[model samples]
Target: MKMFGLRLLLTVFLLVLLELLVINIAGILPFIASHKANISDAPYMEFITDNLQHPIESSTHMIEEKNPLFFLGSGAVVLFTIYATFFMKGGKGKYELADKYGVHGSSRFAQRHEIFKQGETVGVPAKQLMKDLEASMLVSKGEK
Candidate 1:
């Protein structure tokens, strides 16, 4: 849970950073456009004047030629972040641990007719889990 919280925080932080980068760059769009087009290039404006151009411009006259690949790439990144942060589940579906283990079971009640499954096992304690593992390994080796 702590790890998940930390990951979510980091994800949010990255999202904010990306948004700030876009907005800050957008904020100085006019200046960037002015400078790149050999206009009155302002001083102390390197913060927004990356060589990488954004299509969303500040002004019309000083249009800085934009790289569509960069825009598309960043847009995709932002879109993915939003989806992963808000829409995606904690670990189910596309990010399911059960999928990794090839487990066909779903912990959800819907797997049953409406609420309950026919052959669901009760939750096992940790000690029982260890014992089960040992028993399963022995059986697999034809010793049990």
Candidate 2:
């Protein structure tokens, strides 16, 4: 439970970092335009200059194309963070867990439907698959 909480915290921090990355990307000056926008403006004309977002101009963008290793590494980290965060032991289909911790039936109902589907696709015996499907369906009924 403590581990899951920490993982959740890290996931949120990563998301905030991703948002900063997006803002930096948005700050990048356009090299070309659709011809509708004036290209030869105050900067090119000289004497006068204006930036769309001067504050943004200070931040440099990560060049993913030029740095494939960095891109792949960061992407893997982000993906792993996401997987560790919301892949709940908490709830499914409508029946939510009470403790919502990483224990007991905050333990038992852990992704039953998804697990059943994966097992079925991987050729787990049909009888086992059926049992899993039924169990998931039964719990999802929320009748207790």
Candidate 3:
């Protein structure tokens, strides 16, 4: 769980970095382009200094003027991070079951249903099966 949390944090960091890169590029591209005809001729250091001195002021107007795509990109990144962090399953047990029983499916619900069916087939009571499943999951996760 600690490892997973670390990984999640890293993933979120990378996503935010990507969003910032996109937004910054969108915000600064026009200013940079208009400053000079050639890329090499642009006042790169001065632009950086100005932005550093007034980061929000420098980017706000440009961001406001640009199309909604920049905001959409940020929103998409946030949504993706949320989905990945909270909704995604690690599925170690599912993969273990698949390898053991040859069951195949990507859906977590179907995978769990198949496990329940297998437990029933093996004469395990539903209540006991659920307990066993929970125990196994905890053990697999190193929480028990």
- TM-score of every candidate relative to the true structure: 0.32, 0.26, 0.42
Compared with the true structure, the alpha-carbon lDDT of candidate 3 equals 0.68
Give the backbone clash total of model 2.
1
Task: Give the lowest summed-lDDT range of ten residues in model 3.
Answer: 102-111
- lDDT at position 133, candidate 2: 90
The order of the candidates by TM-score, greatest first, is: 3, 1, 2
Cα lDDT, all candidates: 0.59, 0.51, 0.68
* Model 2 residue 37 CA deviation in Å: 13
TM-score of 3: 0.42
Model 1 clash pairs are: none
lDDT of 2 by residue, 22-98 (tens): 43343233322332276655243221122224323423333523444435545765775677577645436333534
Off by over 4 Å in 2: 30-144
The better-scoring model by lDDT among 1 and 3 is: 3
In terms of lDDT, model 1 sits at 0.59
Off by over 4 Å in 1: 33-40, 44-78, 86-144
The most accurate candidate by TM-score is 3
Give all candidate RMSDs, comma-separated. Answer: 13.3, 19.8, 15.4
Q: Residue 125 of candidate 3: its Cα lDDT?
A: 90
Clashes of each: 0, 1, 0
